[model samples]
Target: MRIGLYPGTFDPVTHGHLDIIGRATALVDRLVIGVAINRDKGPLFTLEERVEMIESEVAAIADRTGCEIVAHPFENLLIDCANDVGAKLIVRGLRAVADFEYEFQMVGMNRQLDNTIETVFLMAEAEHQAIASKLVKEIARLGGDVSKFVTPAVREALLARVGRA
Candidate 1:
């Protein structure tokens, strides 16, 4: 089976992230959405909350696309998680040139860790090019409507995180 690993903090999965997941799902037999546990960056939502949000969003898409979404929390290296999940490919979303640069470095590092694991980059939908978790949080925190940038679950999660709703 062609299993792919899509790793990210996914603090609150944005529409852009979901878009990439949907597209990547078509190319792989199963996609594991690895939620990286980063001690350096303080997250807005708890790990459980983040997982719930991602699960709900992915579940909705899976209902329509027949894609399987598995959520795993990885504290070790991404390559290790990929190996554990038997993922030969690592899927990444490219939002802009800056994203390409950052993802490129990570891809190179992953290749160094395991030459057998290849990284695949998918561009975000044009409308969601500027949509990111941080930006979504910022907008929602300030009472701006983010209905177009995230799913209903994410929007509610963001509002709850910011103590707005």
Candidate 2:
């Protein structure tokens, strides 16, 4: 089967992420959502919470696209995580030029590590392009409405995390 790995911290899965996941499902038989355990970032949500949010959010997409979606938490290198999941494709969502510059370097480094795996970039739709987890969290923490950026469940989670709920 054609398996693709999409790696991200997913502190709180946003609509931008869901848009990418929905689009990615059409390209691969199985899409593994790699929830990165990057302690350096100091994510607001736990790895388990992130995985749970992704799982809850992607269920409808999986059903509609007929693609198997699974969440795999990884603390190791992204390439190693892809290898562990048998993913020949690494899917990335691009929001802007800044994202491209970073992702370009990542692809180059990943190619050096494993030439067999290819990275594919999917541009976020215009409406969702500016929706980032960091910004979303900040907005929620400041008592702003985040319903536009995240699902109701994720919005609630963010609010609860920030003690605004």
Q: What is the TM-score of each candidate against the true structure?
A: 0.96, 0.99
Flag regions of model 1 displaced more than 4 Å.
none
Q: Which ten residues in a row have the lowest lDDT in candidate 1?
A: 60-69
Measured on C-alpha atoms, candidate 2 has an lDDT of 0.96
**Candidate 1 clashing pairs?**
none
Error of 1 at 115 (Å): 0.4
- Against the reference, the lDDT scores of all candidates come to 0.89, 0.96
lDDT over C-alpha atoms for residue 111 of model 1: 88
Best by TM-score: 2
lDDT by residue (60-139, candidate 1, tens digit) is: 77777787878888889999999999999999999899999988899889888899999999999899999988888889
Candidate 1: residue 65 Cα off by (Å) = 2.0
